[model samples]
Target: MFVRNGTSTLKKVLTCPPTFLDEAAPINEISKKYQDQPLDKAKLLDEYQQLLDAYAEAGVQVEQLTPQESMTNSVFARDFGGCVKEGYILGSFKEPLRYAEHAAYEEKMAELGIPKILEVKKGLFEGGDFAFLRENIIAVGIIERTNMEGFNELKAGLEPLGYQVYPVPADSRYLHLDMCFNLVDDNLAVAYEEGLPTEFKELLNKLEIEIIKVPEEAIFQHGCNLESLGQHRVLSLKQNKDVNNALREHGMEVIELDITETLKAGGGPHCMTFPLHRV
Candidate 1:
């Protein structure tokens, strides 16, 4: 059983290929709610390919799921499920359009010989809000997609496994906690002040974590949502010039990719991946 630590060296990951985006196709509720602008289908495909290539270069195996024509937001696979110390912990998406993805994640976990440890079935909880800070400290955001009920359920499941759950209140504008804070390396993290509450920062202080504050502009641009590939290596959006520079200045090897089209669908590099095994 492999443990699920986001900052660990990633061994294997799963992603969903961007589905066919027929702009002419009638707009669904999901698209209406999330997509702030028109999507460039071709760019989305190119961007995803670049992401896969980055993973390959980092010596990580990338597996992709067949695209679903009906689900426009399927590309953001991180919200579908999460990897824990025991096995996979499946999530129930708050949006109606994403609920169908539960079955897909379940099947993928089974194929990989990873048992389903638990499922957030009764209430909403997306993997995006769940953050594994250490071997025992787990930070969960009570945000739009994740509520108090879901937070309690996750705590109930993880407490037995020796985990301390910290509930962070997420800004309504941001989708998840990761939208504001993410681990850059062991004992280090990057966060956007505007998206974080004072108590949450105090909690990080108590944990003795070194925090790098990303400029407020970068937060809305999805700069804080970058992914760490262990050993101080990071993958961030190309457009996030300020944050990328900040990460590099802090001694991190930064890999940048243009995710303009993908961001339109409400995610960035970290949101695109569902890591299975990290060492």
Candidate 2:
């Protein structure tokens, strides 16, 4: 039984190694907006290993995903799908380069005996735009990676399952909601206020969730993206010092790793992982 509530402590996670093709893919095609420097193969592999180690040190079981030789962006495994109470929801990709990534995931999910609750093939709907603010409340960002059709499909699938889907307009600058806002603790979150819509903030207020605003410039550094190890523990990028310090002040234990090479690919800890079970 795979289950995840997004904000809870992570117990098991799915990840993929930074394969040769992943780092060899055309950098321009992968992240045109960021125009990141070409990744160093050796450095990228080391950084990915450290990410897996962080989960191990936190007592979270790690399941390595099958790498796709023809795909470059498959290393960002979180975008492939999301784990729900019953099983998994296969996510659709907005970037043409990543469209084929989900096929590998389908095979893997089936091998693991996980059922597909929904397969969003109508339009683009990357998993990075989805998060659970509460068990019954799910927030989905209608961004470049996830469109209205995808949002509607998500709502249609989830609403019948007793979830209230809240749509947050995208800022365009941030590819996903996770880049601007992340649920840290039970009722606390780190957010890039400028990147989020006013209605999104108002919704958080209505839920009485505490929000810590990260500096605008830090959004590119993925300050709002981190992985929870449950019990207020987090896996964060050491380069995101300001946000790490802030999380520490809030009484969360932060395990930091330097992922400069990984960051060049435009993903942090949260983007690199797909949680299968959370406590």
Model 2 residue 95 lDDT score = 71
What is the RMSD, in Å, between candidate 1 and the native fold over all Cα?
Answer: 2.6
Q: How good is model 1 by TM-score?
A: 0.92
| Per-prediction TM-score | 0.92, 0.94
Looking at model 1, residue 56 earns an lDDT score of: 97
**In order, how many clashes per candidate?**
0, 1
lDDT of 2 by residue, 139-162 (tens): 998866888899888889988888
Best by TM-score: 2
Q: lDDT by residue for model 1 over 64-165, one digit each (tens)?
A: 877777766778889986678788788888877676777877787788788888788787788888888887888888867888888888888888988888
Candidate 1 Cα outliers beyond 4 Å, as residue runs: 21-38
